[model samples]
Structure formats: C-alpha cells, structure tokens
Target: MFRMIPPGLAEAARLTRQGRLKEATALLQGSLAGTRPKPTPARPATRGRIFEVDPATGDATPPGRAGFFSRAQGRPRPAPPLAMPEGARFLRGGFGAAQGERAWRLYIPASLPAGPVPLLVMLHGCTQTPEDFAAGTRMNALAEAEPRLVLYPEQSGTANAQRCWNWFQPGDQRRDQGEPALIAGMVRQVMRDHAVDPRRVHVAGLSAGGAAAAIMGESYPELFAAVGVHSGLACGAAQNLPSALAAMRQGGGTSTVLATARPTIVFHADQDRTVHPVNGDQVMARAGAAGLRAEVERGQVPGGHAFTRTRHSDTAGRVMLEQWLVHGGGHAWSGGDAAGSYTDPLGPDASRAMLDFFRRHG
Candidate 1:
C-alpha cells in the first residue's frame, strides 16, 4: 500500500537537506534517544538522604517507615532528563492568581532573534514533572533550534492525588476560575517578562495535560491562538470522578463545538487503552470542522507504527485542524524521547507536528 510522509517529519527532512540537518536531528532526536544512558541502579538507602515522598500528600516519609512504600512501589526509576540544552536556560519560577499558585519551569532558547517570540505553554500528564514532559516530548530540545519560548506549568500534588490538572472537574473547566485562570495568568506573566507575540501564544499537553490544554483553549480562546492535544479527552469530557473514569473508558456526553474554538491539532493511538481514541474525535469536534475542506493521508514512521492523518482546511487552503491516529501505539507521547516517562520513541514526532501547526495559526 502507498504511504505518505508525516508532514512534520517530511518538513524536517527537507530542512535537513537545506543545511538544518544537524540542528533538527539534535533537537528531534529521532535517534538520540537510542544513545540515552542506561538506567542506573538504585542507591542504598542512607540515613539522612533516604526519605520517601508520599505521592498523595507530597510529604516526606521517615526513612525507616518506607517499608510499606517499598513493598507497594517498585524501585524508583532514574530522574527525568533535566539538563539545560547548550546556551539555553531552564529557569524555575512560580505564578499565583485567584484560584491558587503553581510553580513553573520556563525554557528560553539561545541566541534568540530580536523582537517578540512565540510562547508555548505545556502541561504534563499525571505523575509527570515539567522536566519529564519536556524530555518526553523533546519540545525543549526542539526549541533550542526553533527559537520559541516554552513554559511548563506544573501541577501540585496537593491539588490532586496524582498531580493531574483536574481537567474533568467543573470548576477547572471555566475561564475565570480554577486552574484555567491560574494558567492563563502564567501566560500573561511570561508575556510581560519577555516580548511575546500575542497571536503566537499556544498550549499543548499529554493525557491529563492534553485535556487541560483543551480546557485552556475553550476557556481563553482570545489568549491561545491554537491548542494541541495528545492522548487526551475533549474539554468537558467529565464533571466528576465517576464520569472522568467512564470518559476515559469511552467518550463522554458533554458536547460543545463552538465556531470560535481555537485551532486544534490532536494525536491519539487506535490501541490506546487509557483514553479512548473516540475522545480524539470529540476533540476534533470541538475544533468545529464545519465548512472546511477535508483531506486524509496515511503514513508510517520507519521502524515505527503506521498512522492516518486527517487535515481540515479552509477555503483559502490554510489548514485549521489536524488529527492523527497511530495504529498499534499506546497512551504515551507520540515519537517521544526514551529519557522521559510515558514516551513512545517509535511513534511519529508529535512535538514537531504540533509546533508546526501552532506556528501556522500565529
């Protein structure tokens, strides 16, 4: 059967041919992940440094009292990749608003050109840190070559048991309250600190993060020019814990596809057992495809899974939405680095694709 090249990968190959090969490869790391250092063995528990953090309470468990946790949880995996890219800076900061305060990590590129730059807000999945998400998605590495500023708003363990963005909660779904307001305030804070193109502001996430990104777009359409959702549900997919579980198993009943919905790009695997693939359809529905031209393309990453991408464009031939369904893939970030959690290195490069799509709208 004939196949098409995933657009972002194709563009990367083209840019590589035009002398961007080294930079793109360094950033995209389609293969750098293969050379990632082997997982190190866990260290012996020492008296002073051996504290177990309670995932539920974010409190330190006395060293001797870690027996239950040691039995319950497996050996801790190594830390996520948190090294700053050469010449780039990864700084820590915090933002507070009406709802609450959240600590965030900001990634600023090196040798940035004069004037305003694009700002991307990234949300991490449950049990993921900003550093883990960046390493998983390879967005920070990509920003090293692309010059966009990336912000990762971290979810506090105290906010939810799993450090999730509470996207399924009714309070968090609206603009002026809850997580949405806090996150939007962070965007404005970044804009004030650095020159940012208002039209170029965008947000994207994985799983819970992806769901939160949809909520951000829905709540603050005027702030985000576009949104990217991967392995996530549509905004308002759930309003409570029970409904959230059901929505994760199957699509939900909430439906809102306003014409003003921000431009959206989505990725979901047909084999994802966590968030149902039908939720990807729900997210696209929220993008409002009415009156747009539709085109579908099939592609496969070399030595990776096959994918079907549908592009929706306007009368002017500008793409407004893209949805990719990866066959045989799970609920991980697509085409991600092995150094981070919940990443499938064999899938398509979702980071590059989402950024490419975001750049088009802004």
Candidate 2:
C-alpha cells in the first residue's frame, strides 16, 4: 500500500536540513512506529507527600487515600512519577470566598516569562488530591516546559464522601454559589498574587473534576477563556444523586442552555463504564444547540489509540467546541502518565492538546 510520509518525520527532515540534528533525532525516536514510549519508573507511594491534603480542614492526609482505585483483581495501586519538576515551586494554600474556604495547591514554573502568563486551574476527580491528579496527568511537567502557571483546587471530603466536586448539585452549578464561587475565588487569588493574564485563564479536569470544569465554564465564562473536560459530563447534566447516577449511566440530562456556551474541548472513552460515552455526545449536543456548527474528524494515532474528534464552530468557522472520543479506551486521561490514577498512556495526550486549544481562543 502506498503511504504518505508521516508528519513527524516530515518535520524531522526539515529540522535535519536546518542543522538541528538533535531535535530532529528526538522527534524521530518519538515518531518511530510499533514502539511504545518507555514507562516512567514508578516511584514509591510515599513520594506523594505533596498531595496528601485534607481539603476540609487543610491538613495532611495519606496519599493512597487520594482517589478511587480498582485493582485488576490483585493489582497494586499505580506508582507516582518522580517529583515535581526541578525549580517548580509547589505551594499549599487556602482560598476564602463568601461561601467558604477551599484548600488549593499552586504550581509556579521557574521559567515564567515577564508580564502576565496563562493560568490553568485544574479540578481533581473524586477521592483525588491536587498532587495525585497532577502526577497522573503529568501536566505539571508540561507546565515546566511552557513556563505557565497551574492551580489545583481540592474538593473537600466533608462536602462529598468521595471528595468529588459537586457538579450535579444545583448550588454548585451556578455562579457565585457553592463550589463555583470558591474555585473562582482561588483563581482570583492566584491572579492577584501572580501576573496571570485574565484573558488567558483556562480550566480542565478529569471525571468528577471534568464535570465540575464544565459547570465552571457555564457558571463563570468570563473568567475562563476555555474549558477541557476528560471523561466528564457537561454542566446542568444532573440535579441530585439520583439524577447524577442516571446521567452517568444513561446520559442526556441537560437542564439548561446558555445564550452562549463557552468554548469547550471534551475527551471521553468509548469503552468507559464509569461514565457512559453518550455523555460526550450530550456535551456536543448542548454546544450545538447554542448555535455552533459541528465538524467531525475520525482518525487513529499510529501505533496508538484511535479517536473520533468533532470540532464545533460558528458561522464564521470559529471553533467553539472540540469533542474527542477515544476508541477502545477506558475512563482515564488520554496519554496520561502511568504513575497517576485513571490514566491511559496509549491515547492522545489530553494535557498538551488542551493547552494548545486554550492558546487559540485567548
């Protein structure tokens, strides 16, 4: 069969011609077919000291208790990556709002450029701490390279037994109320402390955190330029426990439609059993109902997972929403590190792709 030169090799060849052989060689190694990237050696569970946080009381907790885990019959908990990137300052703090105070962790890259920088507020899934989530997603490493700021807001176990953001709760779903207000307060604190470009602020999360991010985008669109939700539901998809469960299983639980839905990028696994894949469709449905035109693309990454991506645009072809359905995958962050919980390393990298998408809107 005739084949086209892969984009990676094409770029590598260009770099080689430009005398950037080292960069070109690195790209070629990553692009090599049939070879999986070597998994980062698993670090000891005790190494996650930075994430062992009690959101409600702002105290230290055990790392293993950070999230939901389903071992393969007798499999052990996944190991975490090495520590936060060198020179990246990880600070634990609290954000006080009218509703209440929330615990948070901020990742300040050592190489932050002068002037205002982009901020990505990351929400953690049920039973997850900011450290654990960041470890699994390996987003902090990406931030080190981009030299961007990253904020992680912890969901209190006092609020939910699972430590999940209350995305289904009406109080948390609206602006200036419950968790939304508290998270927005955290964002404001970071912005005030550092030179954060308000126009470039973005939010993203996994599962419960992902759903909560969708709610945040809906509740405070002005604060976030874009939103990325991985294995999550759209905002207004549920009201209470029963509805939330139903929506998780059966999907289709849109409660409201905003005049203008914020720019969104959603990633879901077709084989996900924790959250139905149809929820991804509902996210697109809600965005489409809000007047964005939908364009779909289906392809597979060589020697990796296949995906169906749909980009929703406006009349002028401005993208408003991008939905990714990872085929043969489970409920996890696409292209995430093995050290963190609920991550699939074989899929497309959600962290890198989300950052790229956020750049276009702001």
Candidate 3:
C-alpha cells in the first residue's frame, strides 16, 4: 500500500534516502517549525477510582450509573460565566491588502475601564499560531488579571514553510521590510482603533519570534516602550549561516544600532541543549554598550531555573531587564502550562515575569 505523506516531508524523505541526510534534516526541521502535535485528551488513571458526591452534603457516594464522577456532596456547582473574559475577541477578517493574511488576534482586558490601556505585541515562534502561543503562555489570562491588551501577530505557513519570522533573512531583517513592517503596521492599527498609550507600546517573542522582537527594537525603538526576548539572540548578531551558528553556540555579537539609550529589555535563556545560554549574555552586553546604564543581576529559580537581569532605568524611572533562566531546561517556554505546546511549567513562571516587566516599564 502506498503511504500518504506531506509533500514537504516526502521530499525530505526522498533526499535522505538518496544519502542527503543533512539537506533532508534541514528541510524537515524547517517544515516542522512552529508546528506542534495535536493535543491528546487527559485520561484518568485506572489505579484510583473517582466517586460521585452529593450536592446537598459534602459526602462521597458510589459511582453513578454512567460510571463518572460528579460534584461532591453539599457543594454547589460553579455556574459558567455569562460572558467570556473581557477584551478577548477573535477577528477573522484580514487587516489590510496583504492577501492570505488572516486577521490578527487581540486580547484586551475588560478591566480597562480607564481610557487608553497599554498594548503588548507578542510574536509566536516558528510553526506556532497566536492561539497556541496564548494557550501555551497563558498571557491572555495574565492580561485579564492586569487589564492590558495583548496582540498576537501570526506568521502563516505560506509565507515560510517553517512558519518562522524570517528574522535571519537579510531581506526581512530591515526596518521597513517584510514582516517587520507588517508587525509595526499591526501595532499602529491597534493603537488607532483602541485607546492605547503611544509611549507604552511594547514587543516580545520566543526564539525566532524573539529574534524578530530584537530586530524591531533595534529598527523601531521609538515605537516601543521595551522589548522582551526569551531563548533568542540579538539582532544582526550574525550576518551568515556560519556566524549565526557560532553566535547560537558561543554567543557575543556586534552592537545594536538602536537610537535610544538603553531601551528597556527583558532576556530569558535556559542552560541546556539546542540554543546556548550565552546568547543571553550577548544581548545584555550589546544593550549595555548602547549608552544604557545596564545593571546586571544573576540568580536561579526553582526546578533549576536561573536568570540574569540587565536593567536600565529610563527617564521615567521604569525598570526593565532580561530574566528567567532555567538551568536544566531545553528549548521550551518557562512557567508555561504543561498541556500547551513545547512548554515546561517546572521552572519560574515567565508569563508572570513578563507581564510584571511590561507593567513596570510601560
């Protein structure tokens, strides 16, 4: 029987079968970018059986006829809310003339009773969707709690099969080029539609998305209050594949040409396989040399999570820096939901740290 395979993967397999393993691996990795496995249902363990409870009294009873557990005795069932969280609306239509571009996802806090709230533009990693990022990072929940608007700009697979931001590509790395401009345009649209504080707009991302954030921060410093990079490198750190790989491994790079003096930045890295932790060091050093008074603080968190903060206070006395380095972690989001894609919740909660950092700076 003939087996069905994605064209991209089929090509990769053909290449590998022809003794082109390196080419095949690259193709496969790129194709798998930002992609995640479908979520599986959580099955209850058979070792321990769950019993039903009486609604009137706090007492357990034998399993019901359906053999399923119900509410405990005397406990009232929590009614579902009349409405979903405020500022959590899905826009299905496209934003501009960009064809095949779907509408951007926006998460606004209902508690923004005060006019003009802060906005955070969040970019997802390769092969990731806005919904996946929001679900994995739980940033929307934090937005609801803090009442800040979160913008998730998605990169379609059609743009790049890997679903990456193309930050490493020279053509797309410029100030007014490709996805960078698209992202900036999205920010402007959000600002115009909602009462967002112009001075408090910020940008952040993970991995490739983080690299894109660095590019945005370098090219468009005036448009953002701060930038956050998690498990990513500095912008323009490497000009080519060899240098890129070296920087990815050993870190250190040329200084950024950001016009501002030490813009607010938050850096997170994990000391483990895949991306190197030294990348964080390179980011801090580059930011510091750009005339920002960077204060460095290093520490570790639970579950072998460690971090270094390179803070620079702005004229408004707002504090920002890199944070949340997990010592023994892999290429994954820290403090994220375990059920979400490519995340390890064992470390310090990065979402909380990021929100707090954004709030403090913005």
| TM per candidate | 0.79, 0.78, 0.70
Per-residue lDDT for 1-362 in model 1, tens only? 54332233333333323333233333333422433222223333223311112222323233333112111232334446576756889989999976899999999988567799999999988657788788788888788878889999998756853567888789999988999999999999999999998989999998899999999998888899999999999998877654565577678666777764359999999988668899999999877876788899999999999999999998789898999999999878899987777777889999999988987999
Per-residue lDDT of model 3, residues 1-362, tens digit only: 54333345555444433334344445545554734233223232212111111212313222122111112212222222223464466453245544334357887666666788888888877545677677768887777777778898887645654355767567667877777778888888888888998878888888778888888887787898778887777888765443454455457366554454444454454543435777766665665534444566776675456655556655565554544456666666777774345466766677887777766665
lDDT of each: 0.76, 0.74, 0.61
For lDDT, the strongest prediction is 1
Off by over 4 Å in 3: 1-87, 97-103, 240-243, 256-260, 289-320
Error of 2 at 160 (Å): 1.4
Ranking by lDDT: 1, 2, 3
lDDT of 2 by residue, 20-101 (tens): 4344445545665523243233333222112111222222233345334521212224434447656768899998867988
List per-candidate RMSD values in Å: 15.0, 16.7, 13.5
Kindly indicate the candidate among 1 and 3 with the higher lDDT. Answer: 1
Clashes of 3: 16
Predicted model with the maximum TM-score: 1
